[model samples]
Target: MTEASKYGITLEKLRSRAAKGDLTQREIRAYFEPDERRGEAFAPAFKLTEFVDKQGKRPSARTVTELYFGAEMGVVSGPRARLRPRSRGRGITTTASAARMKVLAEGDSWFRLPNLSWPVSYPDDLVDVLRQTYEIPGVAMWGAEIGHMVTVQKNNYLVPLRSGLYRHFMFSGGGNDVLASVQTHVKRFGAAGTNPSSAESYLKASFDGALATVIGHYRTLAGHVRSVSNPKPTLYVHGYAHARPLPGGPYIGAKLEALGFDANSSLARKIVAAMVDRFNVKLKAFAAAENAAHPTYKVVYVNLRPAFTSAADWNTDEIHPSDAGAAKAAARMGDNIAANVPVA
Candidate 1:
């Protein structure tokens, strides 16, 4: 029997379970765990965590599963990292011990993705590589939307940006903003009896409005940074790479299935690719506009589409890259920072 038949972890099964209620950790874990009897050597990137409360009481199975998924995925239920407050009238500032930091990073899971421990130790995200050059201190959480980053959590990053210590500001967001509500942006094929000629056409007809909303958030972030930050740190932003339709990318498989498309279909890939392409294009445009408007405090768009080329470079989820993929993106970002922003 196939893995789906034997393991019951098929997309259809997962969709059904997701539709009904929360899926238990046991179910998701068992699905990803290698079958020793089958001699499968794969090691899952996701790890299960304990779900007991501080009172040492175990929650219900459903609650345990909810906590498991939240912890494993680094879901942002609360502040993942916080900036410490310093002396009087100083407000929130880096501690004296951490005052030497040169870069302030803020964004979603990519900035804080945990290291993969599958076959060996490797750099799984940009934070790992960035920490090599500069002490990165800021708020980067899992599943953070750009809108949240700009509005509700503004001070989380804004206060640090005003410190005048950071010369480079690395941001890794906008992916979640677009990916989370793709159903709204992308239309189902054959909708309104429309026979679109190309993926670009389909996207042009529907995704622009959603993309515009995301860009508005970016503008808000840029405006805040420009106004608040003393010495005005140069902003660095990146767009997502061409991703695979894996189950992990914002639950892509189920989302595609819900939209009446096979997760592995060419149309699905094209749809995702089109969205990513437009996002990158708009980012470049945004960077250009910002740079032209404010010559001193510039916005640099780091192109990371070429980072993950092979399947080996991507994790099973296909949203977060593997160690090799992260290294490539880090290299690209490092190169861009070096070439564009001068040293302090």
Candidate 2:
């Protein structure tokens, strides 16, 4: 029988469990435990916690996973990581100190997707990689539509920005923001938006306008967090690579040439792809500006555009990457993330 048939951990199965409640530690632990006898593969990455710690070592996954359950589930007590949501002026905030420590992953559907088979996407690999590398017991990742994020930190979520807790913050944005607006801007800007640079500028301007409120809210949110954090925090952002003009249905990139956005020939793909690339260009600029302006703390914009370029082999859909593609991305950036993040 297949792993899905044997293990009962299919994508939708996990998603349903996650949606309804926290995954049982026993269940999650079983996922890692060697079961070759039961015809399972051994993953050192999943079970790596027992042996290693990078700089100074941190808590075992056994400890952190205890706290990742549903709100007030109270599966464990006196844990180092905060598990319950408490009173805060605005978005959700976990109690300070006296709680198990954890690293956090935050962003959109791309970050939170729970696919089991044909698993790809950096988030897919990084989830397990994190358990091994950081030695943290748990992580909290959140994501929604761009408008949702801009509206209220993706719906009133300030996250576990506790003082001296949380090791790293990684997320994806601006993709959803630019996706729907692509046709409109291309139509308005006409052929000028076709060039990568021009496409970048147009997309950037649109986000700057559409996302100003979101940006301001994050500033305020970060300010609140910075005040609590001793060294502030470092954040990672990425730009998306371009997708082909194939149909992802009418909602996205289907029939762009017919729509008069693409310039015919490969230029069509290049122009649209360049528009996505613009987000990265803008991300770099945004990070640099923020770092320059701030006396301390930093924001890092990771560039994945080059890696994914002409990488037809790695993509499953026009936009979402295939498993191999996601793995390639995870490999490329894993060390960088490991090196930069604070160890628990």
Candidate 3:
């Protein structure tokens, strides 16, 4: 029998409630919070891989690809793509069975982060950490926005959903959308006479629209997933960690500086934090509404913000989490999934 953590209710109890169809969302979330500190060892019993466009140029992580995709990248060369095991004498088999491929994942860089390092290997992303427990196979690009996932990348995820091979779905997106908004939605300076300490000083009147756009795209994706997945698989979506800005960093930091806010200033960090919190709130609301309307095919939002309060949790890039930070967030996600859904 699998053991439950000392902090939260046992997995047996959660499965019992779920089997009887009485498990509430609040109860599942209660189990999510206390499991933030849990970490798993790096022993991959199965292949950890995602699908990439065969026609387009691949993303980074050339050296560490073997850790996830065995010797060769699982290039979708034919009509159907399949995963291979790791080359380093790992336990994963060359081909995965339908029963083993129960989880499907889709989203942006967080889902498909690359090991950009050359001499030194900076592996272990969110998927890498989570796959320590579940074998995730789907589509995730390095810089995918919600819009991209729904349109050009639609077939990549939809085809798998149509196959009815998966029982659980996971997603991570909208962070890139928020970063894109910072470039255009921030003001040159704070509003006249308003306190510099507030987020309103740095944001423009149109910024709220940007947030709405993210919510709308998320809804669209959820709707797409619902239309095809049979027996209504559980959809788990996660908002990003608390990412602070560095002056020299890319995207968020560079865009903030270009908009006239000092990327390293207290006000700037507060503004970023405010935006991130707002995004999470929107996600939480969406999950509630979606679940209320469709009980069996519930949408679960996993908040990763609490695990990343300290600076040490983030990498030098400031956008992505450090190895330790990824482990923390992954533990929360793995715990949430285990609590709500039963996996063989």
TM-score of each: 0.67, 0.58, 0.70
Tens digits of lDDT, candidate 3, 1-344:
22233224433443344344343333333332211122111111111122211233332343223222221123211122223212112344335433353678888767765322211344456776665567776367556678878877888778887888777788888887665567777776454323446775666667678778888988888888789756567889987866888995666788788867788887778778777877888899999999888765878899998888688888777777777787888888887888877555
Q: What's the count of clashing pairs in each model shown?
A: 0, 7, 0
| lDDT of predicted model 1 | 0.63
lDDT of 1 at 322: 72
lDDT of predicted model 3: 0.63
Q: For candidate 2, lDDT tens digit of each residue in 141-180? A: 2224444554455323334555356556665665556554
- Which lDDT values do the candidates have, in the order given? 0.63, 0.45, 0.63
Ranking by TM-score: 3, 1, 2
Runs of candidate 1 with Cα error greater than 4 angstroms are: 1-101, 114-123, 190-197, 247-250
Q: What is candidate 1's lDDT per residue for 198-236, written digit by digit as tens?
A: 555545445777778888899998998788556778889
Runs in model 3 deviating more than 4 A are 1-72, 75-91, 94-101, 115-120, 192-196
The deviation in Å at residue 230 for candidate 2 is 4.0
Question: In candidate 1, how many clashes are counted?
Answer: 0
